[model samples]
Target: MVLAAEESQNEEPGPAAPVTMFGPDFPFPYDDWLRHPAGLGTIPSRWHGTEVAVVGGGIAGMVAAYELLRLGLRPVLYEAEEIGGRMRSVPFAEHPDVLAEMGAMRFPLAATTLFHYIDTVGLRTRHFPNPLDPHTSSTVIDLEGERYRARTPDELPNVFAEVADAWDKTLQEGAALSTMTQAIAHRDVPTIKSIWNQLVPRLDDQSFYGFLAASPAFTSFRHREIFGQIGFGTGGWDTDFPNSVLEILRIVYTEADADQRLIVGGSNQLPRGIWSHEPADSAHWPAGTSLAGLHGGRPRGAVTELRRTPEGIAVTDADGTRRTYPCVVFTGQHRLLLSTVRCDQSLLPRPHWTALERTHYMSSSKLFVLTDRPFWLDTDPETGEQVMGMTLTDRLPRGVYVFDDGPDRPGLMCLSYTWNDDSQKIAALDPEERLEVLLSALEDIYPSVDIRSHVIAGPVVTTWENEPRFMGAFRANLPGHYRYQRRLFTHFMQRDLPAEQRGLFLAGDDISWTGGFAEGAVTTALNAVWGVVRHLGGACHPDNPGPGDRYDELAPLELPEG
Candidate 1:
């Protein structure tokens, strides 16, 4: 427990340029593309108001819709539930300002593309209270009937330091973390490709746990276990142990898990903001045009069926309304195609179907409760420490984060955030039952404190696996699934595919190389936007080429079929 490591504070700063989610795969500069003065591209006047069906109102769908609107096309969005999708923020009925973020609670500074939209929406962010984060007041690590507190990694015990050193050594010697990090920071394409292409084939079949076991630095079983329980930067990665090692490399290389910040209101604000935002520079539309105005008020209901017709792709909503469009961009969970939506077999190639079927997803669950005040900040006379700090434990609660919105406002607490087996274990419990179980665990950790007394509003719980519209929290590719990931990610480049598959496109974090991050959702959405523009005979500005424009030189490496 408490195995997380902080980045070496002594390491000299390198280049002034920051590391971004540019990609070890595609390496497209989405942030720069968005920032370009030339703008995304335009279509012919004849197709200016052409309707395009966009399934799923999540960040991916919202980005696609917003960019398409800028390109002078109309995007008809459909969602089963709320607009934010997995970036859900549940507010108490009485205190609307007091919110509990059930998903996507933290966002890293490296997600520049996502930040583009955040800044566009004029939202503010503060440093998130992750374990050992500098902004955090304190951190408590409870492991197997033992408890320890620390404000910094150096304050932790010797074994924790050893575990941290072992992890750093493992990444350096085994994964070339520094080389990739430098390559990414400087946007050194050739160097990135050279290192990544070599590693793809060599490590695609390796699991995260397998990679750790094989590492000379992580030879100790105890060290590996501790590292798995509490990973560096973020929380425990044991749930990701079965995923491909390459997944882990992508995050560390770009520092995607480091220096995270939470949006002032909530992460949901980004999607919701885009929904109502009117782009001042958009084409074809007059000033004050917004996605909200286009749809009248809200998006259409969920899509129940999809089929190719003589005219184009046909979409049937849950309300029995049907519409046909020349192209459709699907940003929902890929597995939805096989279950919730009655999709035509010809919509995708057989190999792509296989990829969809083989895709793996990780289950996630969270429980949040509102507190009367920031009681956790109160000092305990006995220990002279904050009553409760950000916590990481081996107990059922797993991890607990405290969010204080000034002493005058109600505080929100995520009592438990668990993934995979841990998530499934408590999936059957009701919200109150879940709260009780978590409170019991916390009581054992802080016997002197009375957490139940501070509770003001609900214990909202979400088991993403149980949500019909979203089968899982996010995709996590298993060992040897690199081929599947490549196929799905590259589907946007449809020239090689048959005519039928060309019109239907995929865009989501699940379809991205680095799944589970908002950056992936934004980048893949841009890819789909490019794909849509191309499908309608539009082209990006020569000065500002899109991802597909550079597909030849910067495409992800392909493994041998055999």
Candidate 2:
């Protein structure tokens, strides 16, 4: 799991990275690609009128379709549910100005690709109130019936500082996190691969729990437990202890959980904005054409089946309209492709099939509430301390984020953001029940504040675990799944695939080296674009290299055989 916590135990190593978000490995500069003077490598004029099927209206799908349209191909996008997919944002009916980021709430500065899209869409962002971030006036760490208000690291108990120190030491000594991060920052692929290859052999099979146990920094079980319950960056990672260490390393290395920010209004503005923005230059369509216009202002229905024809690929929508396209880019959850959509087995090879089956998705649940005002900002009369701030606890509601809109305007609060078992447990309960449980837990932490009294709007709850559209929130690799991951991540470069599987390409966060991140989804979508362009006999501009153009240099470090 990219972000989850669990009790420290005797877990062995698995194919996971040290707990960090993995950055992009492509040779193409994203800013340049976004502009690309040539616009995603000019496809032959012959393919301009050709129609391409883009399944899924999520970020990956929308990005892919936008690029394809610019390249001159007609991309008909299909969606099972809403656009923006997991990056959903909904405003309270009573308070339209206030928003509840139901899906992906925070994004890191390191995610250049995601930011590029954000910038292109002209979306504004503000510093997210992560625990202990300066944006947060205070932080409450409540665990084991003990409560501590922390404004700075120094204010916390010696053990909390020790936990921080231990994590730093472990990342440096055990995972070579410093070295890898430097390579990534410098875009030095060779150095990264060289350093990563050595670690993969030793750590590929290791579990995150094993990494903590083996680290001298976490010698004491109590320290490990503390680290698990109250983790650095994105809350406790105990739920991720059973996941592969590689997954954790990628997240930590990329600083995925640090320097985070939230879209000023809502993250959904990004996708919605892009859907309406006109590319400076485009193909068969006019330069001013928007994706919404191309689909007549509405996306096609969900895809029901995908099969191959003698010509290209055949896709059937829910309405039973069968369209054949020379190329198809699938940017949805792979599990849905296999179960929800009836895909022909011949479309993918056996190895790719197995990888999809093995891909693990972590469950997540989020509940948001809009209050009359930033009541949490009000100082307690007796202690002169803020009632609440960003909170991290081991109780029912693990993480709470206070959204201070203004002094008088309504404020928003992420009452609960949980993962794994906690998320699943909440899914069983209805929204009202979940709200009750969340308030009860918060009352225990802030007994003086009548949190319920200030609530003017409802507690909107979202459970991504059991959602049929998306079975789980994001992708996570289990222990010993490095080989499976390698295949999935590399699938975008179809040159290695058999002829039958050449046209149908998979692109999603699940197919990326780093899952649970929009950066991964964007990069993978671009990778599929490169593959699709090549499939249609299109060549990338010599000056602007695509992912496949630099595949040899940018490929991930291979996991050595056992």
Candidate 3:
């Protein structure tokens, strides 16, 4: 669809803009991810006097918005960019295809809040890139390997059992270290180092890695070289010294299969539907701004300041637009909170704010290329075109991800990933040469895939590094620090303070989940809602079993005692 080049500066927003393609120049709503697809239009502000104001438009913001709506109250949701915030959607090589996420590629099933919203949207989801999908059955851990194996979900139970068998007896010996492990495993504000310091070396005289590898659950066995007979084969290093890194292993090895799956079609669908009722009632959303502020209109500038209010809270947008409310639950990065938060020149509320400053984050960069062919995907035997959704990860020397941007003509699209530490260092390499280096690495992992050339190449980055507001990845506990996830922030979220203080409350991944995750973000939102409800003279979920308690019925998962 070529544009009719006429007016150089047309006031009217039309096809002249064409909008950035999310995938292959498709005509889907590209501005606000919450407006994805044609099922719903913009929402209108029919009612007035919203009870709360939800800041940030990412996972936490969306979840908080839903909760506010469920409890017969209204909330004005604001975002600086797309509704998915970090989970932004991008266009692919040509026309009709778009990548659905930029930040947070995957999550675990333990996310109670994300699943709740999924069920509410009534959207269908499929297991993500499972070994179950024959199209992708050959799941290669490395790009050059090309050799795909089934997903590891089938091995979850065995992994857990093996880890358990080896250490369970030792842990249950009524020893001081065993008791300490059990304690660290249950708390919200603890870290691997802290736990290790208290529960292991300091107490148990063991290390994390020792505890995991010694367990029978994690070790993998293979065939003994015969095709006919079914048999388990493996090698082992018998040792008594505890490796001490069992906690980190549980994140992937024990929980991978248990992670929640993605929606079948597009992740945008869930947010789009939730923000505005598709096929039912669309939102009262301001144009261009999927969700906007009540008094300040759609947030059009930087949010420079944030503070508590008498009834809720007050915020100043980029344009210095300040408004007051009773409650403000942050749904974006904590940096946003830190940036807008007015800290006294003196010391902060110890261990909390200082700890936040110390929390780490990685830089993220991507290069989106529109190509006539998906250069990385190996040619299909039948179509002679590259396979769509081909994935290349750290396997690339430069570090990147490659997938079809869109389905039209099978144009190629390549995105490279780099941490904040290296984004500047790798700035000199041109896109093509960069692709070469990255693809060479892919070859080492999946030698069969070839990308001799391409249609387009460029870099795309999510500036989490400079955006001090976010601190780091959504909810990283960093290595050796997982406990701070819940403990440190929980105090901030509680609403038991005086009325003057209830004006400000905390919400997001930092407050609820162990790490920066959609689930935690949503859970924090739910708790925020509960706080607001209490403020509104409304009953708690235990007292009121309405929309607020939609997912309260699901039984919570109980982690094993360390």
Runs in model 3 with CA error above 4 Å? 1-51, 107-112, 130-135, 141-260, 278-301, 308-312, 340-351, 362-433, 443-449, 454-463, 466-471, 479-483, 492-500, 514-516, 541-562
lDDT of 2 by residue, 229-310 (tens): 8898867999899999888988887789888999998888887887888987786887689899888998999999999889
lDDT of 3 by residue, 394-472 (tens): 2333333343433455543434555444454444565566656655665565445444455443333344554445545
- Where does candidate 2 stray beyond 4 Å? 1-32, 560-562
Q: After superposition, how far is residue 173 of candidate 1 from its true place, in Å?
A: 0.6
Per-residue lDDT of candidate 1, residues 1-562 (tens digit): 1122233332654656789887899899999999999998888889988899999999999999999999999999999999999999888886888888988989999999999999999999999999999998999988888898988989988998999999888888777777778778878787788778778888899999998898888889988888888766877878889999999999988899899999998889999999999999988899999999999989999999999998999999989999999999999998999998999999999989999999998999999888999999999998899999999998999999999979988888999999999999899999889988889999999999999999988888999999988879999999999999999999999988878877998999999998899899989999999999898899999999999999999999988778
Reference-based lDDT, each prediction? 0.90, 0.84, 0.43
**Ordered list by TM-score, greatest first:** 1, 2, 3
The backbone clash count of each candidate, in order, is 0, 36, 67
Alpha-carbon shift of residue 127 in model 3 (angstroms):
3.4
The candidate 1 region of ten consecutive residues with least summed lDDT is 1-10
Best by lDDT: 1
TM-score of 1: 0.97
Q: In terms of TM-score, which candidate is strongest?
A: 1
- Deviation (Å) of 307 in candidate 1: 0.6
